[model samples]
Target: MGAWGISTFDNDDAADWLADLSDHQSLALVRETIAAALDADDYLEAPEASTALAACELIAAAIGRPSAAARKQETLTRWIAHRKPSPDTALIADALRAIDRVLGPESELRELWEETEDYAAWQADVVQLRSRLSH
Candidate 1:
C-alpha cells in the first residue's frame, strides 16, 4: 500500500488498498503513472513501467478498450528484441511476469484474454522461460 505503482504490498494489504480506492482515484493515479512511464526515455528501465503497463491494460478494460493489451504486448516485444543481453532484460521480463500475475484466473480481464485463440500460445514467444520456474 506504500505506492499504487508496484505490487510491493502483501496479499492482504494489496487487497485492502485496492478495495479502499475509489474508481476515480484509481484511474487518476494509473493515468498519471502511465504518463510518467511514457515520458521516460527507457520505460524498460523505468521503475514505473510494470505498474504503468498493467494499469493501462486495466484502465483500458474499464473503459471498454480491448486493444490496450495488444499494444502493450507489441511494446514489450520491441523492448525484448532491443534490450536482450542488456541489464534491462530482467526489467522487461519482470514486467511481463507482473502482467501475467495480474491477468490470472479470477480476473474478468483474464476471461477476455482467454477468449483470444492464441494469446496463451504466444507466451513462449514473448518470454524465454525454459520452464515456469527455471528462468
Candidate 2:
C-alpha cells in the first residue's frame, strides 16, 4: 500500500522505476505529484500529505538542474498561469501557495498578471514542448 492507499507498484519496483526515468519523465512526474497534492482534501492523513510533499520535492529537485527538459519547463510555466478556483480545492491551493512562497512573489506570482492574454499561446507552447520531449 502507498500514500492514500494508491499503490501502483511494489516499493522496490517503484523506487527503481522512479530512479530510471529520463530527465523529462522525472520532471513531469514531479509536477504531476504537486498537482495531486493540490487536489487532496481535508480528510487527508499526515502520511498521505507527507508522501505527496516528498514526491513533489523529489521532482522539484530533478528540475533544479539547468538541463531539465522543455516539457518540465513548460509544465511549470502553464501551471503557474492557471488561477486557483474560488473556493479553491485545498490541496492544490496549499501546494500552489507553498510553491509561490518558495519561488517568491515575483515571476511565478507576478507573471500571472503579465501572461493573461498570452496564456493560451504559452500553454500551446508547453504542449509542443512535451511532444518534442516525448520523441
Candidate 3:
C-alpha cells in the first residue's frame, strides 16, 4: 500500500529515482506528483497529500523558503483526518496551505494559482517547467 495506489515496489523505485535527480529534476517530480494528486480522476487521498506536502517542503527548501519546513512539520503533526467523512478535502486543504506558506508571492506556484484556478492549466505550466530539468 502506497500513495496514488502505487505498490511498495513502485514507491521504492520512485525513491531511488528521486535520489538520482538534480534540483530541477526533483522539482519536476514534485510538480508532477502535485498535479497527479489533485487530479479528480485519481481521487486525491491522504498519502498523496502527504507526498505533495513533502514535495512542497523540499521545493521550498531548494528555493529558500525558510518557514516551509516548520509549517509543514507542524501541520503534519496536527493532521489526524485520515479516514474521516472525506480525506480528499482535508488533503487538498493541507496541500494548498503548504503551498501558500512554503512559496512566496513571487514564486511560480503562487503566480500560477493566481492566474488560473484550473488544475489542468497549471499542470501545463508544470510540464513546461519539466522541460527545463535538463538545463
Q: For this target, which candidate reaches the highest TM-score against the unseen true structure?
A: 3
After TM-score superposition, the amount by which residue 92's alpha carbon in candidate 3 deviates from its true location, in angstroms, is 14
Residue ranges of candidate 1 with Cα displaced over 4 Å: 1-26, 65-135
Cα lDDT tens digits, model 2, 68-108, are: 33133333334323421122234334444434332233233
lDDT of 1 by residue, 16-84 (tens): 423333333224554454455445442233234334444434333333332323344443333333433
Clashes of 2: 2
What lDDT, from 0 to 1, does candidate 2 have? 0.35
Worst 10 residues of 1 by lDDT: 125-134
List the global CA lDDT of all models.
0.37, 0.35, 0.37
Q: Order the candidates by TM-score, highest first.
A: 3, 1, 2
- Report model 3's TM-score to 2 decimal places: 0.33
lDDT of 3 by residue, 1-135 (tens): 232212111233334433433333223555566665556242334344445545543343333332322234422222212211122333434445434332334343334344644545544433332222212
Candidate 3 residue spans exceeding 4 A from truth: 1-26, 67-135
TM-score of each model, in listed order: 0.31, 0.29, 0.33
Error of 2 at 74 (Å): 26
